[model samples]
Target chain A: MAYRENEAEAHDEEHHEHHIMSPKVLIGTWLGLMVLTGLTVGAIKVDFGAQANLIVAMAIAGAKAMLVCLIFMHLWFDQKYNVMIFFGSVIFVVLFISITFIDTKRNEPFRDAYDATNKPTPEGRVLVEPTVSPISTSGSDAAAQPGELKVPEHQKPKVPWPSQLPDTPRVAPTAH
Target chain B: MSEAAIDADAAHEDDDHGHHDEPFLGHHFKDHDHQFNTGKLGIWLFLGQELLFFGGLFCAYAIYRGMHPEIFVEGHHFLDVNLGAINTCVLLFSSLTAAWSVRMAQLGNKKGLMLMIALTIACAFGFLGIKYIEYSHKFHEGILWGQLFAPSPEAMEHAMHGVEANSRLHIFFSIYFVMTGLHGIHVIGGIIAYAWLLKRAAAGHFGPNYYGPVDFIALYWHLVDLVWIFLFPLLYLIH
Candidate 1:
């Protein structure tokens, strides 16, 4: 046991010098992350177009992820092979998702159906095909009323959808 | 021993004696640099797989959100922004401390490593605590996934400000639960991993030449933070 203790002490004496980041870097990274998070919250208050907002949020998120990877994860100082492995996986994921979306976007009938039902307007959405008066907010029972087709008073669409008008002439050849 | 064999052993000893006698460096490794590089490559591959694992869910989220953008805007309101932001900060702070621990281990500062590990573990628990609060609120409000989603009357009133009751709202919550739940599991994994590393650190198993565990675990912790970095804005701050 004494000999083992002596060995341990000797091991301790043989100091191994390596790279050590100053505390300033850690603090700076932490502060930067916190500020970016604050920015995310703040950006939501501004009424950018929905797509723009999504893009902005995602951009901020991507930036934060990069910081974590490069600094906190030390990918900046890590081997080139490791970086290559990481980006390769990211590329595969993006490819998989993009391919799936390309297919999903191509299907016309389903896309139109989804749009008509789930997203009735560019400004407002009508997710459910309500049978009853939307003004009646008592409960689900009020939603059971049929034939009226009353749009909810609170969620009224900003502009009437062209599809909802019977008087408008159909431009498609099939309509004639 | 045969004379030639004895000579070979002597030569091997001579070759290794002046070089790093890093205790953790395996016999098969040629040198410290070789061992570190191999371990680093393995960790990066592991991290890459982790990205793909979460990528599948992110793809699903993107596709569904594209299909029904309105549901996300409505569903996000049910999530508290302050709680999510706080959690994000907590996780970010934990990541910093985790990175610091690796640095400390690299510099042979055992005390600093132990302290940083403790701080990281504490921040992780703090994140979970906030998450629990947010989840319990959602549970009570009946904002749940799939068939179980029965938004309360109050929630319905708020969401219906300019839209009808969204039937597909359940899908949003499903994504929310799955993504965040997976992230939470990662946080727990980080906590357990850090605790183990802390024990090892206390036992003086790490130093400049052999701080592999500390470094690898820091990378894992950063990935956990990275996932949350996306989840926070996507799930909570959506307009």
Candidate 2:
């Protein structure tokens, strides 16, 4: 063990240069993340339309994630291979999401027809032709202009089952 | 440089076999640097795999949101943005402490390392505590996933003030619970890791040449924070 220790010490002397991140950088990263969080929340108030809002929110989140990775996780000072591995995973994620989205988009019409025809009414009544387009993306506009989108009556479910039914089953006599 | 010297060194190494100078150094490793580098590589690979694991859920989220924008518009109203924002800040602060703990371990500051680890654990618990509040409120309101979703009248009345409730609001809640619940589980895992780290740190197991575990765990914690960074905007601050 003594000889092994000496050998280990010799190796350490030759190849022991680890980076220790400074507290200043860590604190700064935290602050940046917090500010980005605030911006994401704040951006929701401004009317950027649905798509633009999503883009802005995602952009801010991406920035915050980058800060966490580069500073807190030390990817900036890490080996190039580690960076490659991380980005490779991110690339795969993009591929997975985008490919799945393309497929979903292709089959959207079939899904819409199925949902329109199969959706059960709150009252258990027969399905009705949807008064409004189920796949409408203008939800904010619909909300703003309330009269433009007719509020569906089925949104509110009538509860409390009637106590007496006309077709109730009668009890049978028991054998002696 | 002679064969005789090499033989004598091997004999001396065998004589000292039972008494290791650095007990923490694995016997299989040639040196601390070698062990640290190998462990670092292993951890980076694990982290990459973890990203792919989470990417599956993110894909599901994008698909769902794209299909039903109204559901997200209505469902997000029920989530407390303030609580989610607070949790985000809590995780970010924990990440900071986690990184600081690695630095402390590298500098051989045992007390500082322990303190940072404890802070990180506390912040994780605090984040979970906030999540518990949000989840319990939803549970009480019957805001659940799939067939179990039966939002109470009061909840609907409160949540759907001016907007109409989509029939597929349950899908939104389903995504919400799955994404955030998985994140919560990860936070629990981080707490457990930090607790173990704290115990080892107390025993002086980490120092300048042996802080690999500390660095690896901090890298993991930052990834957790990274996930939440996206989750906060996607789940809570939906436009």
**Residue A148 alpha-carbon offset, candidate 2, angstroms:** 22
Q: Once model 1 is optimally superposed onto the true structure by TM-score, how far is the C-alpha of residue A103 displaced, in angstroms?
A: 1.0
RMSD of each: 12.6, 11.3
For model 2, residues B102-166, the per-residue Cα lDDT tens digits are: 99999999999999999999999999999999999999989898768888888998989755588
Off by more than 4 A, model 2: A1-16, A123-176, B1-19
- Per residue, candidate 2 scores C-alpha lDDT tens digits across A52-161 of 99999999989888888887888777666788999999999999999999888765654554465455456432443333343333543322333333324433213311
lDDT, each prediction: 0.79, 0.82
The most accurate candidate by DockQ is 2
lDDT string for model 1 (B130-233, tens) is 99998898898898888788878887777676556665678899999999999999989989999999999999999877888898889888888888898888
After superposing candidate 1 on the true structure, give the runs of residues whose Cα lies further than 4 Å from its correct spot.
A1-17, A114-176, B1-22, B158-163
